[model samples]
Target: MSDLAHLPATQALKLFRTRALSPVELMTAVIERAEAVEPRVNALSETMFEQALEQARKAEHAYVHGEPRPLEGLPVATKDEQPIAGRRASDGSLAYAGHVADTTHPVVERVIAAGGIVHARTTTPEFCCAAYTHSRLWGITRNPWNLDYSPGGSSGGAGAALASGTATLATGSDIGGSIRLPAAATGTVGYKPPYGRVPAMSPYNLDHYCHDGPMARTVADCALLQNVIVGPHPADVVSIRPAVHVPERLGDVAGLRIAYSPDLGNWEIEPDVAANTRAVADALATAGAVVEQVEVPLRRADVMRAAFIHFGAIFGPMVAGVADAHRDELTPYALAFAEDSRAALARDGFLAGLELEGRIYAVIGDLLDRYDALICPTAGAAALPAGEDYVDTKLTVNGVQLDHYLEYSLTPVFNIAGRCPVLNVPSGLSSYGVPTGVQIVGRSYDDATVFRIGAAVERVLPWPTRPQL
Candidate 1:
């Protein structure tokens, strides 16, 4: 039997509404689970025991009084980057290690108003930059499936906690695949809403590529959280006005056109990863979706140029002041990349890249004009072994040597295009016993479509009941 009583928010909500389980009882179980797994996963930085219990007590009263909120009493974890009033909003760096938010971030405020209780701040990469979730302040967040592997980053802790059943649901932010990569690594479901779907106020205003969204063990529960956190804030120009309706139903896939790209046409993908994802396409076909292998037009474009320019813009000014003082502490690759950004990229380059990105986005739009969704592996390999910073370039699959970090190549494309995509289901275990995931790409502003397709795919895919921690 699963020791921590693994329950998704949907079922937990049912019990909460029926008064079958008190909020205190649920909170106790969640806290116990988190405590139980912390030694191995290192997924959480700080647990808000007293505050969470206080909120649970109030939630129990509300439930008994029949005044339940949208998430009434449900336990939720937040990425450490989200500002939580008195709690530290450490971006997993020594630079801002002890900093506290004076007020809650808009998303955190919304979740609180909707009746969710926050118990902890999950770990993140330094300044939320790296693909692996490890930092000087919080150490490393390991995979729930196998403690020796990564859970993905910068929202790595959120994914790890969900997979370990440490919390019912968690929030994740995506900028260059932060949310999706971790979700893929931990075998959880993560969604990247269209740019501005969830209002954000970053110090840098990363409206172009950054997104804050929901992650969970199941789709319906993810939708439940999404329903609560979306809508416009006056401070955010890009936030979409409330979505007219949040989809609760998983649509049938019988007639949907699913474009399957095993390697996204030109990118490098491992053979085992390709085979595992190919099996998903076959499963979708069996589920009655019309599946076809198609070449991604961007694959033929100067993607490396596009990726470098886009990244350089975001990291250039971010580290300009600290590069000299922190040079010794920063990773060699990051320092090298930052120096390159300082030397060459400029405002015109970023604007030009944005313009180019828009044109390429139109190409994807053209493809979506004919197809309902795109399906592919979320990463080229399973989670890397523990303590490994980057996957080895020598790892080859089907005669392909990985060029960049295997995880980024798959999920960063959607971020560049501002598409609403979801990492739906795990393909299954690797020979090393780590988990792998599949990506479901949908059209802009069509997050529900991705959710619908992901739900269907999840039903068809063989989701693991428990990770071998």
Candidate 2:
């Protein structure tokens, strides 16, 4: 049962098809694993164990009858921020603490249609506003590698579950690196598909930088789940027509021209993270890909400024609408974000952000034209304290102080270039035991190239699925 909890979805499906494993047995193992780790990590916002068991029984019958569906019986941990009809979608906010979603998000609907059981819904920061996963509503989500550090946010719980063997596969949404950052910190694989590659719930679905994708232990496992979740839907107008399928066996990266940037222009990175990024570049070069260190004309401040503008213009106003009615109930960080957003929006920050985004993309587009893909460190440092406050906290990388806690992340830059696909794959583990990762940024809307590079990286540097939890 314990070993079953750690089986990858691809391998588990093989076992299920051969009648060597039953969905009931797999669900029971995952339920037990979740129980064992939830106390330590607080990854799950809610659990549907009995419902999952019922679904697993149905899946078991299907397998015996030779009528198994895609992802039949597989356990999926959904992010709490996404709606799952009739379930509580608190989104780590006190304002909506008692709110039940009336409709399920397209991603969750697709997961169910493909026969994936939602055993648990994972935690997120308040409205998923912060980079680290601690919120007043769900407490802190700790990393499996080092419990004192965060699993990484927004999708922090999803990443934590994959690392702790609490779930076979999980869902994640990236708007400014939510999915990738947590995956990088936890030694998991997270894909931030190009904008509209997967359907999303509005009004965020309309936002160009937002994406919902898959997270898993292996790149192939991630691809398997992605195939089930992606494709256009009537619910989201922005969803691209004619869904793209990512092949399970993305072959080697030979004769490919890849670019590596240590600093993406101006951001301080920790020594361990820098070394691991370089190691990955070297490994890719040895794998027959032409990996070159190139300088990208991007400044950390410009990226941060643009991200804040977008957040202020879109997410801030939405949050403020709720906070206005329940000001006393909101978290301090959420409150501050609401307040700061008003100020930024008042100063024409949103328009300025749009202009800067064009400038940033000019440089990125040129690089993509010259190279097949670009690789860079996912975050400036490894996981920070699990309970760190985003608003008041300060991060110092290589003796230099970051302007904001979120400044340590190198993900939002790609969000500024929203059309490109990005995948975060583990590079190495830090001295503290937490893993470091590199992002494979592909050409605009060219999702397969990033996965191909990620698959090659995985082959060279195989990562362990679960930590010593």
Q: Best by TM-score, which number?
A: 2
- For residues 98-154, write the lDDT of model 1, one tens digit per residue: 588787777888889999998887898776776778766777789988777888877
- For residues 1-469, write the lDDT of model 2, one tens digit per residue: 7788989999999999999999999999999988888899889889999999999999999999989888999999999888988888787888888998899989999999999999999999898887889887888899999999999988999999999888999999999999999999999999999999999988999999899999999888899989988889998999998999997668889999999999899888999999999999998998899999999989998888778788888888988998989888888888887777677667766778799899999999999999999999999998878897766766887789887778899999999999999999999999899999999999998988998999889888777777886
> Candidate 2: deviation at residue 112, Å?
0.4
Superposed on all Cα atoms, the candidates' RMSDs to the truth, in angstroms, are 2.5, 1.1
- TM-score, prediction 2: 0.98
User: For candidate 2, what is the lDDT?
Assistant: 0.90
Error at 76, model 2, angstroms: 0.3
Off by over 4 Å in 1: 1-5, 203-206, 328-337, 343-348, 391-403, 406-408
Give the range where candidate 2 is weakest over 10 consecutive residues by summed lDDT.
Answer: 341-350
Model 1 compared with the native: what TM-score?
Answer: 0.93
| Count of clashing residue pairs in every prediction | 2, 0
Instruction: Give residue 1's error in model 1 in angstroms.
Output: 9.2
